[model samples]
Target: MKHILSLFLIHTFTSYCQDTTYNHFSVDAEFGLNNPIYPMTSGYDAATLNLWHVGLGFRYAVNPKFGVRLSGGYDNFRELAGTPSFSSEYYRVSLEGVANLGNIMDFKEWTKHIGLLFHMGAGYSVLNGSSIDPNHILHGIIGFTPQVRLSPRFNLYVDGSVLANIYQNYTYDLNSTRNTHGIDAYLINLSLGVQYNFGRKEHADWVVIPENNEEIQNLRKRVEKLEEMQRDDDNDGVANWLDQEPETPAGTLVDTKGRTLAPRDSDGDNIPDDLDDCPFEKGSAAMKGCPERSGSMAPNSSKEVITMIEESEVKFETDKADLSPSFQQLLKAIAKVMKDNPSYKLHIMGHADDRASEEYNMNLSRERANAARTYLIEQGVSGDRLTTEGFGETKLKNPLRTVEARAENRRVEFDVR
Candidate 1:
């Protein structure tokens, strides 16, 4: 029995090695026996036989879905009868294997699956009945077994078959001659049991694997949507890792290496504030986006800068500097900036729209500038930091041929020293 099992294992392993492919294999050892009753005689009616089969085998699961196995073992049968006190033994050794035809369920992954297995094949064996002078009975055999799998590589196996070719006869003096039959039922030596996954196992083919796609447009879109939900814009190449702005859109202006673009210095302006620079000017790099000017300018020191302007068409309503109340909030906002930056002292010099005497307009301009200055002081600005000048009708910001041009001449601006 050991020799036959050894031969089967050698063939199974050698075949697997030659293929050089991935396959599942399991080694199994099975032991089983059956008992029978013979009640033909009444004197002592109970009789039984202890028939056992023991063997080891190997199975190759070629694919996740199907497999084959070659296995065989030894069979021992002891018969006990009580009708005239008779006893005998039958010994048989068999080699059988199977081709797994198919599986009931599709097993594409490493998960729990329920399925049925159909096995059809047989074994060759040497048999003998101890009572009949003990010669050997040899025969070719055929059978089948159906099984169920509780897990991958684990199963409950069953088999039964019929035997042909050898018979034995024994005559007893106490009764008529009796002849034992040569043909036998295979299920008569049936076995049942379970199998485990055991050692040196491979990863389950059914498990799902993860994937990656480089620089895909769709993935980019998804990233954008996600960023929008988070609210970051500028899309400057800053990624989430380096990105202080969490709301950046996906695919924003990023660098060649996929990071957000460094803050742009398109004009080489020293100032980096995108919102502070004039769009049309070519600003200085060190000045932070502010362009250099050729006109006489007051230094920004202490914020109380003094400057001059020529305007003639600008006008004032009598002595009052009140802008149409509609412009009140606008004027107030300017006042707030002064309050916020206390060093910002402004000088408002008003002018007539070239329609009044220079003296009268100059007087009116001073009063108007003073009136405007009063409003800022009222809005929390320091009176000492402000001054009013009356350029009157002597200066014109634009040609006075048109009323709209005249209107441009009347304005107020902060002067810094």
Candidate 2:
């Protein structure tokens, strides 16, 4: 009993420095064998294997490192007669503090599936079918329980304990000359069991968002008002808030940045030179300020308009939809042409090289096309006047596997109707 208490104390002191993140509550049931080690005996009694014990227990943890358990059990010493021991049956109850060494030793990961624990407590024991009367006794217990974690909520454990009690008599009188009924005794017990834990969530770190604050709402309103105040709805020099002639034609001269001035026409044509494609030559406003082509002013076919747009200098950054200043300038010209020819609608097809996943490339191509569409919209072209499509590495301008060919494939194609 002294050795067992010493061992428990040594382990407890050494394990005060490890991880304590163990579960807080559990229940267990056990079954095993137990036998009395008669007082002053050096070893176990040589009895048959039939004697057994069964028990159930519940534990509540105070923290990751410490817990208390209430346990009750019955011991059947069926082979009591075969051995030199008394007390054929024993029933006991104890309340113990169990020290979790896994947490205290910092071995949680390496011992993820197993743990070592120690416990000590006091209890009352009932001794039945004993001679010399006085069958009830108070006992002290110390134990070592090793557990195997079987799941998040379950564990398998094997427990061993040393118990000390005072009994009124000994069934076998070692000294016939002395009537010593009041003596110290001991029992050695072993059990196999399963334990269950409960009540913690799988993930404990996710946070929920609360309602927006009044300050955030006020800031949003202020930003919207500032955007309205600074907006230039027309490409003309004036801001929309101050502009009187908001729908002035492209390139028309304006006064103090708001009102349009009568545009000069160098030629005798009724078309203003600023709006003329052929400013120095006689022209008609209906023909884009240009004279009739091949003696007639008829609209070009969709194919010709597409070819003209395809020749324009517009490019995108690699793997991105952002346009450069030069490309933005070209887009403004394209928007002007689209607005002047209201019947002509654009079909914008974006493409990507075979350098990424098909789905990723497809999305990249779509973003590029949308970028173009958005720029045209910002430049005053109607959304209905344009359509967009993405072809990811399915159509290549040059099919050869080379850097130049890949670059050529990474482009947008234009079609008009």
Candidate 3:
């Protein structure tokens, strides 16, 4: 377990630093021909083999690296020899693992959907045949399945598989016999099937809105009014009421207390743009928050990483612990950071597991949230910048667990802007 955890962390951190990838699931049904191999002594080639199979299955596209599928088929077998020889009907299950090549943009699912797929599993034929024994039919499978996405979230899979009995004995006596797993003897067939994909979606794809001149102007006017109320209209580091940096020009940054800070190059290089030995010299974050470049580079720019991060669990300590100083401090720091960075909002979604009394937990979470706001105020943060809510115990973090589960009962998390 320790080794596994380390490997998982390595893989996760590596993948996190890489580009984004997506996956999906699907189910399908199809029909195809089944040919059986008969011994020369029993009769001619096994053309009498006809297949009628109904399959129910699930597929998982693990990652761009690999994926898999599982399918169970119930089939009726018949021999097409001179006389219609009905063998037995049986259930067969197959699992296939596929490897994806380099993925293209449009064929996003193909990395998980399409690839070279190999199968290995056990199956059985249960019908009583004149010369067939139920215990003798140990089955094996192997093949390739390629998938194509016809539309977003809807995929098509076509596969060719080989299924056969492991024993060389084409003819089976009434007595039961065992066969080696890897070796193939009498079984042989080629099949083709298709499946439609479902589930995966691209919800985060941006929905764009053209610039509204009226709305922009309205927002500007609201900002002006907010400044007027403060009455520090110069927008300097010092407020008009306490102008310590009276000489400081307009457009200077102000702290929460409206105090001025020393002027320094945030993106530090020995040569500051204004008086640097080399203004154009590129440097590290230590010298300046900005990096000098041959061409213009925006500070906010980043390589987009499209991620589907599932919600995290929120756990509550004991009832009395809700009022602990540690808890208050935690909320205080969180609220302060969020208020300062208005562009990044913290989503305070409070939820509880089904074990709690709905009204009780709801009231409890609400009260705890009020405490959260008060602590933030003590940290010199504004209340209008935050919102809170309680979901009672309606949604569960894990339905499989009962009340004792940690984080299953209560939680909170943050999302990027």
Q: What TM-score does each of the candidates earn? A: 0.33, 0.39, 0.35
Per-residue C-alpha lDDT of model 2 across residues 1-417, encoded as one tens digit per residue: 999996785455334312223335567899987766664233324253434789988776665566788999887664335445433667899999888776676556565677788899988887665443436777789999987877766789899998887552443222111234443677788989998664442100010111233466788899999888767677765677788888887765665456876654534577654466644446577877666667454443234445657655345556877765445555665776677678878888888888889999899888888888999999899999899999877887789878787778777767777
- Score residue 319 of candidate 2 by CA lDDT: 83
The TM-score of predicted model 2 comes to: 0.39
lDDT of 3 by residue, 335-359 (tens): 4334445554444556555555779
Ranking by TM-score: 2, 3, 1
Off by over 4 Å in 3: 1-21, 38-41, 48-51, 81-84, 101-133, 167-182, 200-417
Name the top TM-score candidate: 2
Report the number of the highest-lDDT candidate.
2
How many clashes would you count in candidate 3? 13
lDDT of 3: 0.48
Candidate 1 per-residue lDDT over residues 278-355, each given as its tens digit: 212345655434456556742222221112111111233444556543233334544544554566666667666576
TM-score of 1: 0.33
Which RMSD values do the candidates have, in order?
23.6, 16.6, 26.4
